[model samples]
Target: MALLALVLLAQVPPAQADPPISQPAGPHAVGLRVIQPAAPREAGLPAQVLIWYPADTSVSDAPPLRYGDLMATRLSALRTDLSATQLREGRAQQQASLMRRLGVSGQAVLDAPLQARSQAVPAPGRFPLVVYAAGVGGPADENADLFEYLASHGYVVVSSVGMGADGREVEETLAHVEPQVATLQALIRQAPQWTAADPQRVAVMGWSWGGMSNLFAAARDPQIGAIISLDGTREPALTRQIDVQRLTAPWLYVSRSPDTIAQIQRSGIDTTFSLLNAAQYAEVTQLIVYPMQHADFVSRRMREASDAGYGEYSRAEVRQAFGMVALYVRHFLDAHLRQQASSLEFLARKPVANGAVPHSLRIDIRPPAKP
Candidate 1:
């Protein structure tokens, strides 16, 4: 029976006809597809995924492309146009501000399952799936640059557009998150290019609010082998989650202290880390708080020159964050997803600068909530 199901599933392609395309799609912009259930599919919530990657080969002798990179030439173009002055000019770091300031002036609605539809450049291929969520009221593609960053490195990154606060009431974001996760898993399980991917090696990442949801999502789904928080700290979602034991996956929760969601000061999220039972903040999980603030984790300033945004760390500091996110996710996923050898440095805990360290993170390995 299982063999028959596999045979039937194999016949289905990764996407439907008139496929929903990835933004900046093509060999030039080409990364991969986010497998999506038809927007109007009669089922519950529809699903979709979009991914980008460094091609099997590059046109020039530039440095090997980074994840979410269009390719060396393209990134170089964006980078070359960037200048220190431009980087410090305006609120470029506040992705929301930058987005609002540069409103979708010329975009045409594209009709997505969740989004109002805006212009998206189409690129396609088989790659890893990196699921992304937006900041508070932020568009799904608001962080395309980041998604592109990961996709270019040879992964299919999906950014789900949930209900927005723009012109509508914000429904519970969780409403559709699970279906999206399911869709992504289906794409991996049934995607045409699963062979190019390490099935066991998928990662869920998001900035701010998305990050919080992903943290909770990771806890709930054991199949999610790795979890990443880009400048997001534990809030009600990660810290005070009701069903604590529902989560057990290894996490790389990275954040900057000053950023709004970076640290939930009121909730005492930091305490969750240090207070966890030794087994809770066990070897499998780790969290790192950067000296920099939230914007520092996003290399947006690196891509576009401007500083009129949340205070920043440094291109060098922000760059450190990018590297760490990629390195850790790469390491964890590679080992678990690809079933291949990878450095466990990411999983290692470094000693504190102060000799008075009792615990690095405060986590309590408590039992599951009563039904």
Candidate 2:
């Protein structure tokens, strides 16, 4: 049966393959702390918030983060065995035995962080908060690398696990939005204890469906200072329900496919740019990565590439693409959340930072006339 499964896996789509991904080194050493905060909206389901932050010491020699069991549990529940073994075996620094024989392990660390210790004294001042939501059928740590990098760079990154349809069930995706928002609100309420979290400056980011949720949350809640999307768009009905023009937060969207961007445009999100208010579209930046599948936004350990759109690139290429994507994410947060003018200036000048990347990527800033 295992042999037959492997054969069937080989026939699976290229987009579905699990490629190895490195944490993409960041400035500060990273640390993690997990909290289960129950939101009032979905009191039955307590949300699990994975908090990643800059460590007081270097994490180079710290024990690697492990998530093989997490991936296996999520996958087995979905009836997908495509790369469960690979995830299970590569729990540490090395690949699983089966993947090693196939020569397909692409150098990914399943876990990130040296220790689960909290940084005492809170790294000088309260850090801006980043509430991250995962894609449909994804866990909070689906984009572990991105969260770790943000945390390492003096940000309090919080992601919810039970707030999304994280087990490959699309039908439940939309229904989880309100609960996800409630979860984030509850986490914010508890931020005073986190010490590192700055309740005043909060940014919400997400991948795929999570992206749409954050967008909705931003529309409803004015407290969110910024918004970031990893290839997510409005669900049509969402546009009709909420008035996006009321959303004044600076927005950054990094998408892999043009279709998704067009979908956002068709949903009338693009029209908000032309409003008379000068600040309406000043900070809205849309980035489209070429030759990058939706899976690239995800960590290699748990990516479901088969169902992703076409054009398969090697592991190295995917890493380079995502690194660039991460850079944009970092700089955007710096500009909006941290209120750094230099970061915004740098982004305007160097929109697409392609350092020998195989494909040509494009970054579009709204209005085209903003400084």
Candidate 3:
């Protein structure tokens, strides 16, 4: 399966330190903390939290978050199994293939400098807060373009990087997701930036393992008004298969229709059937498909990202796939935060030919827009 290849290929990104690329609108100061509950729980481990809010571009005193044993040392161990050159080559090859498929050379966005990553224009006001959690072993920068776009546009979105993958082993990646969610909720309680946050305007998003992380977080976090999952599978986080229906918030599931055809064909109908049998429904649940590969979601880092049997994209699909996800996310967040009546209109948008697909969406009710 491409997912298997993609999972294995995930190990090859170079371990080299990201170059010092600073965002210019501000120096981008940083703060770091660990959220380990005072009490014990199963497989208890400390989760790290990093805050990178708006900073003065002229400032140079910000300290980088330390992955500690996760990134620096553990990745060193993985090198024993996978050579650095091989990983770099794999990443470079994967990236090159994706770009060729996406069209255009160097013009593609990757490894952007801080000045370039920064926004010179100030936000209209303190934007809504978006809390993000990457799936097991997912990188914070994987969905970077989207996160940066939202932040630049005025929303404060926070993401937690999982501990597994890379050359290092983390809290066993998937195993750590639940705690990540717990810690995220805790952080919201512990921090002042959070109380100042808009309660009605918050959203959560994740991809792959991050998607599961996103769902688990939302299931536990009532403050999250909405959620988005990018090509994430549901099997990983379920304690019992019947637990899928626990979700109550608006949800948007974005999957690559053809890329996951085999995966869905193999298990789609069965899962959807069970999803319904389990009584899982949403006030707003919609799935959007793009004519691109699963890996296309990470357009910014296609080299370091790949999957087996994953074909490359043409420039058009790349523009459509990545750009589409961005647009979908922005629209979803705005609909929830600003409560635009038209935005919630999607909850009501569905094909007339509902019989054409095995699964159909049901939006219970759309809330009236804010005054």
Candidate 4:
């Protein structure tokens, strides 16, 4: 609910252009392409995905991806009449064009070109795969910065263009989680057509409701190499659906607040029926970012809030929160997806005071309790 509010409240009358934000500090340049994959099931959902990967060619000639379209599609999915409105009225395309004209398309990178299908790096030289699910009513590209960042760093990042929620109710949200995850898995299977992607070394991440879906997906398929949750929590109904006892993949949960953890515990989702529930789940590392909101995980929110002068933080402060989270994400993926053990040190270290921005990062690695 708070996650939804973050998206809703952050939207204000267009003001000055978004502040200049730092790009991901990866060595290789980023490339992006779009795909429309048919759902594996009769979910009536055609997954519109954005693929970001390492690029060998110059991407400066291309135009930035549309921000309004991604934001509009995401917002539409949250309402009950999405099909009748955006789908029937043809608003998605129109909205994207409008945003582009507004000069607030929210492009992740300036002029990152689409990589050619034929020139893709060959097999035996594939990159680790990552499928990221957006929060409820949030577009896959909501965290475009992170996706581009990971791709530039040599990981194939696949994110959906629009993950329809259809309704705002909690139960409606829960029912859609598994289907979205399944859709993501179906898209990953199309890796051979897009780039040199290694599906075997896959990682799945989500925010809020998507995080709940991430847990369900990992539970269903233990082969997932790792899981990342950006302030995601499991409801009582979700725990009833999947047995978390079967989850074994490594997990990284970064929370904006403790109330979420408290909610999970109160809902009886933290280790009552299953021996390996949240409290007993091994291989899970939890990180808390203080003075941050649920929306901070979303990069676009910071820029929008800063431009509108809506939130408490300044442009610099907002960029700082966004940067810290991005750094941790890069480190976590580097450690798990790339198998770089040393990267974990950045996550484990305590934050040092730098005056301008407060570094209130808390890390806790939880191993399975003694049986």
What lDDT would each prediction earn against the true structure? Answer: 0.43, 0.61, 0.48, 0.62
Off by over 4 Å in 1: 1-37, 40-49, 58-128, 142-149, 164-200, 237-239, 258-284, 287-291, 299-305, 310-312, 339-341, 346-371
lDDT of 3 by residue, 241-341 (tens): 32344666677766665335676677643443422223245554445554545555653343333233245544343444455456556667778777878
Model 1 per-residue lDDT at 277: 36
Q: What TM-score does each of the candidates earn?
A: 0.53, 0.70, 0.58, 0.71
Q: After TM-score superposition, what is the CA distance of residue 52 in candidate 1 from its true location, in Å?
A: 1.9
lDDT of 1 by residue, 26-120 (tens): 23333333334454234332233344444443333333222222211222221334555654442233334433543431011111122111212
RMSD of 4: 8.4
Q: In candidate 4, which residue pairs get closer than 3 Å at backbone N, Cα or C atoms, i.e. clash? A: none
Q: Rank the candidates by TM-score, best first.
A: 4, 2, 3, 1
Which candidate, 1 or 2, has the higher lDDT?
A: 2
* Per-candidate RMSD, Å: 16.5, 8.3, 11.0, 8.4
Q: Whole-model lDDT, candidate 4?
A: 0.62
Cα lDDT of model 2 by residue, 117-183, tens digit: 4433234567888988777657766776677677768888877563443422545335656666665
Local distance difference test, candidate 2? 0.61
Can you tell me which runs of candidate 3 are displaced by over 4 Å? 1-125, 164-176, 190-196, 236-246, 258-281, 303-312, 345-371
Task: Spell out the clash pairs found in candidate 2.
Answer: 15-305, 15-306, 16-305, 16-306, 65-111, 137-166
Worst 10-residue lDDT window for candidate 2 reads: 106-115
